[model samples]
Target: MTERMSAEEFRAIRHEPKPSKYRNRKTVVDGIKFDSKREAQFYASLKQLERAGQVYEVELQKPYALTVNGQLVCTYRCDFAFYDAIQKRNRVVDIKGVATKDFNIKRKLMLAVYGIDVEVIR
Candidate 1:
């Protein structure tokens, strides 16, 4: 087996590749991840919805911002958004273990501006 490299050698390795990759990738302004269990649940639910043909499209962890009067006014990341074929609108679905004051405020604002319904699933 090859001997382990010294800490100094590891530190000296080039890191320029990472920055280039980061720049090319899409950046999210705001977003949150579900704690493991919730994440699994959400993934399963999405699959079910797709099979049922209830969701036309699904946008996962999308970060969006709107500029108002030349200033960036509203910005918030949605957990999961599903498009309804019948309604022809986007709906935001968030999986939360518990509710908070901040969540309420942001949810309301996002719904109004984006014209989407926000649903919290526990």
Candidate 2:
């Protein structure tokens, strides 16, 4: 039988810092840590739009949960959510260098569950 590790111990081993194979680096702006520079740039643009009164409000890392019969199936975190006063609707945005299969599934689920179509920025 294999020995079981506690959750904390498993997380400690799982999340240990390691060099990334890709060159994309994490960046911090306005006390927010972004996964990539492209995401940070997009956030800056959102702020500019907000200041210019184009966007009513901006939120970062909006989370959506997929559930069936009150049981949680999964959770998806989008990069940004904003109310577009011009469009008179709320928009969910995601910054992606590449769209993974899991993201596609979550995007579809967001539509089916929340009826929001996620806008992707490559």
TM-scores for candidates 1 onward, in order: 0.58, 0.80
What C-alpha RMSD separates each model from the true structure? 9.1, 7.9
Report lDDT (Cα) of residue 44, candidate 1. Answer: 71
lDDT (10s digit) by residue, model 2, range 1-122:
99999999999999998865555689998999999999999998889899999997688997888886788889999999999989999999999888889999999988988899999999
Error of 1 at 94 (Å): 0.7
lDDT of each: 0.68, 0.90
Q: Which ten residues in a row are the worst by lDDT in model 2?
A: 16-25
Superposed Cα deviation of residue 114, candidate 1 (Å): 2.2
Q: Which stretches of candidate 1 lie over 4 Å from their true place?
A: 1-34, 66-70, 86-88
In model 2, pairs of residues that clash are none
